[model samples]
Target: MISCACPEFALDNNPDTRAAMERITAAEADLLAARAAFYPQLGVTVEYNRTNNPMYSFGNILNQGLFTNTIDFNDPGTTDAIQAKGVLQYRIYNGGRDAAAMDAAINREQASVFDNETVRLQLQANIVRAFCSIVQAEEVVTARQSALEAISASLAVAQARFEEGSLLKEEVLNLEVQQARAEERLIHARHCLSLAQRGFLRLLGLQGAAVQLDAQGSPAQEIPANPDINRRPELQAMAAQIRMLEAMVRQAEGGHAPTADLFGSYQVDRGAEFGDGSGNSWTTGIRLNYALFNGGRTGAEVERAKALLREAREKRQHLELACTLEMEQAVLALHQEEERLKVTAKMVTSARESARLSRLRFKEGLLLSSELIDTENRLTDAQLSHSLATASRTIAIADLRRAVGLPQFNHGK
Candidate 1:
């Protein structure tokens, strides 16, 4: 029965994952602001002023209906006036600038969503690679332990033969030396496993979490025959960028056109001397504004925006070619690792048989101690090679999946 358990991908506690999610939220906020810009604004204003000017002194008195009490208007004294107002303003037209800006913001937000997915997939791939490393290292440690045990048995046999005068002291010493070397290798292998575990834990944001990894190697699978770059997040992001640049071009050209807004306000005026005779007024109108010229600034902005659009298109083209090359390379690597794994599997089987035969021959006086040690070393190396080949194949598969923008792995915890 399989005793290993696969990790589940947990993005909740990861710092980089949280950061990517936050970026998407920020982009959403920008999109909302862009949409809100299309609506009208309402505001209230209140003011109190004391004016001593000749024109305002008389005007305030008339406005407040206090002229009857101020019969000596020739002595136009200071006037204290209080005003409260409510204002409404709305942009009726702006040459499609708001539309372009909103479109650009929408594209940016979509791109951010794609970027977040890309980060997630990339992190999952990393986790897969790290876990595979730990699995490979653990296998190596197991292989080394097995080798140590076999060598210790051989050393005991040699010691017994030496005591019975059937083996030389030098042969026994040679077996002891091999035993020591095997033990040394086992120690190194265990250390490698420790390091791999540490790295795996750190990647999961669990610095000291006790865990058992179950990175089972999957059966050999066929590489993707035709991978499409369009589905890739990077390409989608580029496409969004192109759209945003096009929107920017529209926004820049909009500057050459006039803008119109509807504005209205209602006000109440009261004077200190004529508080009971307050007056109210209302005003409303549509305002038109045009930027006649700005020293070629508008023209320059339009040109710049067009240039940026072209640049984005060119970059997308370049990236498409690069992705194609990367996918091809990943596929080729997968095939190579698959072949290497097959060859190493055969080697491991043959080496194990040879080691088993050599142990028997050494015990029956048909093989020298040195010969047995050589066979044992070859078996250990074969096991290690097979382990590495298995890991390489697994990693290659993960890379190919990532190259084709496939989010298939479960990782974490």
Candidate 2:
């Protein structure tokens, strides 16, 4: 049996959880990329060209120190030049665009972390439900097996009485019919158990593995008197999303501010042969840019970002409402399942006692065969009901853990 007391048994291997982890990594990478704007950018290029294009040829000759009075101004003739150049640029100012972008990326990474927590919480709840199902199914199968054993025992006694000419053949035949039916019931219960086991295995990502479920029931859980889910991961995720959107709005607004950058370049050129021209030259300066007109694109982008921010805030509001509703619903469900379990436990006790008395009465010729069959069925049904009620209570507690954002459930005792 797989132990769900620790999430690593399933969580580290689950496909959904793995995908969430990847998303977290992706978000972190995006944050790193955003922060790159704070650093200098440098590029190097080396190229050799042979051309007679008027503009480039003249510039190349001047750069290579080959421009002389002897060369005809009208035609510089074909020339081959090799130039190696490096440029460096660093943004001096851009309002707060870079800072806002970095903030947005940080918030996005936070949102991804919360999202992964949400996935893990839901997965824990699902594992609990599946584990409960397997446990319940196993109990049901055992109950049916017991009922079948009781029926077979009664059938044997009836057969002996019929052979001794004391009991009617019809009575024996009725018992025989019920015995067969009880066997069918047992077979079906086992089938359900097998299916439940398979589902549990699938949840743990252990498909086609040999199945064996723990028959031990989960420990009783006390529903918190004032269960609150204000700190649920989903709500936190939405809040992070809203913050990220707010940063995007700020980033957009920064677009209207003029941008300034410091730039420098170094170049070396060769003409006719390598290293035959002006050895090296360097240029450095500060540049400024402002988009005086752009068909209203910048304004449109700012408006769009504001709109998205507004939408995200509204979504967060909706998420808060959802979290409240989920918490209330989970509490109510736990309460109901607890009461149901209590009732079913009493029912099983009463039915088991009744079945036992009926069996004694039938052997003593004080009860009809049909009445015995009815009592047997009632006992089996009560057993199944109690098992179902227990499983339901376990599942409800798991859901409460999920609603409240607990790391993982601890139903094991």
Candidate 3:
């Protein structure tokens, strides 16, 4: 015996992912229903009737001492009839409607599988993007903390200089303002981090569980070569649609062909009379039906089916174009984001050096508190920009993968 746990209540597993699997199961069920069309049908029927008067009749009496025998009948309050029939009907021939229907069902099932895959891929991409956001926010918090420390040190120096009448009160006030701003940024960064974490947990369908994510930053992976966008689930789904429509067209064309069926049935009946008698009956026959004309209705249906097939094809073409454009845009965006990240990284280094130099000069009474505060703000901005750029690049890559039907980061491994 095999035991399976229900995934519906699994907290660690994503519900969207589970739903995608369920959709495939549902499609299988549909296919089963379609298969049932090829099986025989069995039915039972019962009927009852009541009559106030009953007819009596006497058959010819045999010559025996010149005597005639009469039969009398009593009216039953109600009469009951029951019949059970097992009918076996098979299509000996048709315009090809049955075959077309089966083909359409198969295409529909295939499309459903593709749709499920598409959903799964999309959800995986979302998870990657959300995780990236959380990491970026955490980095921002660290950068803000560093800026806060720098601002606090500058304020302390400004206070000492003011006490010695070497710095103006306004200079100390400016340093205090910078410290407040840094604290505000840190608070905002923390809030953003919390939100991102919660979103990630929700995507994994773990609402109440605490999550700890590994935050090791590594160089981005190289893009895969020669991605076949046509094989993407989205495009595959569209292709399936076109195939299904073609099947429909074939079915409609079959409407103009003759249909034939072979059927057989057996029945038994019982009668209550002077002498109870039972009888059995059997029937076997073939039926031929042909729709010679239907006032142009069949023609209209054929045309309509053809139109739908064409529409599906056109829609697929449009989607292919759109996908190509999106892929190109994503590639360009990733490149731009990567370049910006490099520039911001350099900026952060430069700002850090400038801040360090200004702090030392201020402590020696060679620079003002304002200069140190400005450098600290510049460093904070540069760090934040770098983090944002990195997040953007990560998200862009995920998007590109999704557009081309590639798997997101490995969740199973």
Candidate 4:
């Protein structure tokens, strides 16, 4: 995990990150619902009826214990009845489908957690890239400003020589043109810096907020020699998926087995009055259900589940290989950038010394104006290249960290 204490670490504030978190919460709710399926269900029912049927009315009066000797047996009966009932049902067994479904739900929730972690890591990688861009832009602007100052000083020297009649007017004009070009480069660099800052803010989902980038250059940290790709969030998610598929296969196979349930109910019946004298009755029983035949539907479902399990295994194998390849490629790229940074650093030192000597020689009339201009241009190019190399190295390290599942930059260093 990245322990960076900078404002860039406000990753939870990002909408994508929050959305991923919500997915995990939803998966947890689904898991709870699945587990709840194992418990017994209880329900209540209330009913009222007014009837004038000879048989039904007589039966209702008997049930309520309200039958009287004065009632004529041959006459059609009338009944005003109210009943309240409570029922309890429990699944004794269901071909093991309930257990398998619960397992699948657990695995699904675990997979969602890994997926959420993957999203967080990806967001961290993006933030690192954006932060490095701002740093690169700043360096470029500083290099361009330095180059402009050098050219301006050269122009002043050329004008002074021209007035002393020691240098041609055309040479002074050439220096003036170089100064104009250098100024244009400085302006372009500043514009690029502004654009990069805007993009960084946008990535953080704080587009209108004023933010300052504090990174000066490449961050120093220990690079791991051997990283385990098995720890990657993507691989963890795939593993969870495989478990879920296996559980689903078990659930489908359970469809071929028999199911048993226990059920019980109690009722109170009142005649002619809502809450007056009443009679009560209760009953309990065990029921068994077996799917003797359903046109091979259960068989087809089992086959489909097995096929999905096979596909999930194959996909996991492919991703394992891909993860290995990605790790190797990222390591190679990081090494290349590290070497490039060193080469650019040396180039900047050599170019600066060469430019300094060229300027001294020009003042002593030992170097031509064109030679001096070439040295200055080489110095500017070297500075710019150094800046780019620094930024590239920083980004490469961030990429390597992500490939190894170390998503956040270590702010401790």
Q: TM-score of each candidate?
A: 0.91, 0.94, 0.86, 0.90
Candidate 1 C-alpha error for residue 211, in Å: 1.8
Stretches of candidate 2 off by over 4 Å are 1-8, 215-225, 273-275, 410-413
Worst 10 residues of 2 by lDDT: 213-222
State the weakest 10-residue window (summed lDDT) of model 3: 56-65
**Which of 2 and 3 is the better model by TM-score?**
2
Residue 51 lDDT in candidate 3: 31
Winner on lDDT between 1 and 2 is 2
Across 340-384, the per-residue lDDT of candidate 2 in tens digits comes to 999999999999999999999999888889999999999999999
How well does model 2 score by local distance difference test? 0.84
CA lDDT, every model vs. true structure: 0.83, 0.84, 0.74, 0.82
lDDT of 1 by residue, 221-242 (tens): 3455676666788899889989
Please estimate how well model 4 matches the true structure, expressed as its whole-model Cα lDDT. Answer: 0.82
- Candidate 3 at 397: error in angstroms? 1.8
Which of the two, 1 or 2, has more TM-score? 2
- Residue-level lDDT of model 4, residues 1-413, one tens digit each, is 12233434656677887888899999899899989879999999999988887787777777787778887666646677788999999999998899999999999999999988788777877777787787788888888898889878877887788888889888788788888888898899989888887777766766566557655333564475687686788889989989998999999999999999999999988875423547899989999999899999999999999999899889999988988888888888889988999999999999999999988887866877778889999998999898888878777777777777775546631
